[model samples]
Target: MFTNTDSLLPRDDVVKFFEDAKTLLELRQDNNVEFWQNMDATALEIWLREDHPDKADTLNSRICLSALRELLSRHLAKMRCAAEWVHRIFEVSISELKSHPDYFILFSELCDDHPELLRDAYIHYGLAQAVQTLMARWYLQPKAEPLAGAKRALPHTFVKASDNEALARLLSRRWTSGDRFYADRDLLRPVVGDACTERKVLIFTRLKESENDSLSLAFDRARTVIEQGPRTSRLTETFADGLLRLPLTSSAGYLEHVRSRVAVLYLFDDRALFVEYPWNRSGTGHQRLAHAYSIGDKALPVQGTDYPVEQYDEVDTLFGWQQVYVPELPEWAAKALAGPSVHVPTSVRANS
Candidate 1:
């Protein structure tokens, strides 16, 4: 489902524009750039709004502005040039740039040579394409049937590691620092093991007390899985203590407690996860999780509807959070953790 056209500008056009822009900059004559002049950030914003009213409020425009800001900042940092002079060279008209889709790409390349502008872009534009290609080769094909026999349950042992060093020792391998921002195939080699071609990995994390620490770890794990390959793993996060099987008792003699928490769902086919966690504040985790779930399946869908129920799928058996079930975990309780806008099937609600 991902295409190269999803970028604000095509890669080829971006490179070409960078070359052209560089050539233009070499021409220092006053007649070479009569309209080119420096402007502040506010002036730049005003010019964009005036020139391209239709695109002024769009996401692409925001990305363009972000790219420009970075470019200006970088120039100022290196050259110590006046902001106005930097603007003159960079601030061509926003309306005119729209006609040439390569403008933003060119600007971005000139600034940071990276394929993605924002973190979301890295996920959606860069990672999404990689995932889509992998999914087409794996999940879309007919799966082979298991051999005819009563299969014994695979023996599994749970090992608790106090820290990364302990985890590395348990795995009988040394751990290396990994780039958490981008997923690459080699980073996941150790986690997937020798039968990496056939086996799948799933990373799940649920945080109860430390939201910031938990989410950060979740993202790191997700990126590692992603770099390994699409369909190799899926990552999900929830702020509910119940999801992690942590005991929560009410002091007011109430059976259920209603507290806002956040959850994140990442599909292998898409690059970006659904929810944006607040790394700074407290108590908004549930609200952030609910907002992510509400965005529909264009990103992550409601479990049991778009895809089969996985081990980590959290469901509310009742109309609300009064009762919850995680079928894979085989856990049920009256006071279950549930997101505010989590999707509930009509049949499940009716049964409740």
Candidate 2:
């Protein structure tokens, strides 16, 4: 596998990032609740002044402003949108803005003043705007709704905008701008020659019901189905629309198991036959099923609905045939490993 190297940022810049992150992490650990609940800009400034004296003047100057911005923006994303860790992310942006406040101001204004503008915007705009507004308000306003106050604090929006433009005049940072190349079926199409098998077997496994043992069974059945080739057999149909529900966290675990199995399986034959199952279940399917199950009678989908009774039969559909790989380890076994009795390798494998 090719290792992705850092583009062109200086070693010093990267080193500073890790050092700052370490200090920030330590600060967070010490004042857990205060870190989230309250903004103590002055205290942060004082700490920066004393501890990171070399970077103090600059760090202290921006601490409160950045913290405030991060706090509010994260709160906004959480309250307004059920976004994940909206605050922590915004804090990072605020830090970036410390060196370039002007750009941050304009960016914040755009995101806050026009929430809908970044609907189609990529990660950069969304992340930038989310952070900028909060930081600008924290530094510039001493009262509530600081961004709103800043709107009037300046002689005009244009003047504030000019101040932002002036900040842009300072040190310019170079970032690599380009499109990301994701690995997909299309990318592999060329490498897969014409001699490849036209058939594709997509296993639909449910993580919820599958014990590690059950997963072994499922994989065995999947392989048998694959060996049978892509016929319009009952197994084929079952593999297509079968729904599997598991605990949300277990989904990643199941996928990792599947990926590792496939990686080992591929070593046997390099033939252009795609056999892995599709994990991308339709959100609509889940919603519809949830609605059906929530009904007063708890009846399964009947004649009227698109899902026929025969189609939804799980047992008749799954567990028909199979192989034995990593038999599902017992939950008790997992628990035992947590203690000293059992030993699991310390090396952690990243999920595919």
Candidate 3:
């Protein structure tokens, strides 16, 4: 099978030796196998560094020799009848492999280059150890956080506001922006045209204690528009409250807020409109506001945003801050937010 050998070797000499060994294994018709018929350690060393200007170092020689010997052994194992040619190429016996100073390194490289070789228990252990060491070295490297400006286009529809006035203006704008078409008519009419069955409108929001009245007014206007529809049953709406406190300015707190807020929206499976009022403190101590909207199951931040959040711990009191009956919540989420032994408040259950 074809393989990229260049990725395995750091030096040209090592690469050449690996190429020759691979060629021997493939047994190409044009290749002169007879050249290795009487090959020995001294002859192999000369062949390994034939075109190189500098003399071969002891380490390179040993690495190449160890690689060739192991390849020959594997080849012989598969094609027992080729023992004569294998012995000629690998003058050193299998026992010599154990005593070779560089055998472990070579064997680990072989296992990495051809993972199928890991079917052998010894090769698997050597490969595991080698991989562990490499991972350890990688973990020691310093890493830096990505700049916020590097973010790509957001996946969901979002708008930002600088303060409470801006937030109120944004909500008013959303309410009237598309209401003209349904002004004289009905809002839910467009949603449930001919359906006589019961329909539900689910709403998710982050309620601020100071701006509750304005926010409630906005919600009432939205409901009024929906109630204009002609339906067999009264329009049912579910409003789930988000975190009472905003996240701290630190990256850790910001990420925790995001996870908890997102989880609230994820609990509702039916088609619902989720609105978020995220507030963060600026260096000047002014609160910045941002609103995000998404349809059911289509909302969470793009995969790129998840990387930064993963670096921090999840908020502990995720769902505990506010409790609402979400009978449709997936079993996993229910267990994660509230254990089996936890009691649900009567008022919260009734509202849910």
lDDT of 1: 0.26
Cα distance off (Å), candidate 3, residue 27: 41
Candidate 1: Cα lDDT at 215: 28
Per-candidate total of colliding backbone pairs: 8, 12, 0
What lDDT tens digits, residue by residue, belong to model 3 across residues 1-352?
1146855533554446556644433331111223223233343334334433264563366765565555444433333223222232234434344223333344355446545445542532333443333222223234453455432111121122222222222233222111111010012222222221111212232322233322222121110001111221111111222122222221222322121112112111122122322211221112111111111122433233211221112322122222122223233322232322222111111110
Instruction: Give every collision pair in model 3.
Output: none
lDDT of 1 at 349: 9
Q: Which is the winner by lDDT between candidate 2 and candidate 3?
A: 2
Pitting candidate 1 against candidate 2, the one with the higher TM-score is 2
Clashing pairs in model 1, backbone N/Cα/C closer than 3 A: 37-88, 38-84, 184-227, 261-285, 261-286, 262-285, 262-286, 263-289
Give me the runs in candidate 2 sitting further than 4 Å from their true place. 1-289, 295-338, 341-343, 346-351
Model 2 TM-score, all chains together? 0.22
Q: Give lDDT tens digits, candidate 1, residues 23-132.
A: 33223112111212222334333433433456544515455456554543342222222222223333442224322323323334423532332343333323333223
lDDT of 2 by residue, 138-178 (tens): 33334333343222111000011122221121102221121
- Score residue 313 of candidate 2 by CA lDDT: 31
Which candidate comes out best when scored by TM-score? 2
Model 3 spans > 4 angstroms off: 1-107, 110-117, 120-142, 146-203, 209-320, 323-325, 329-352
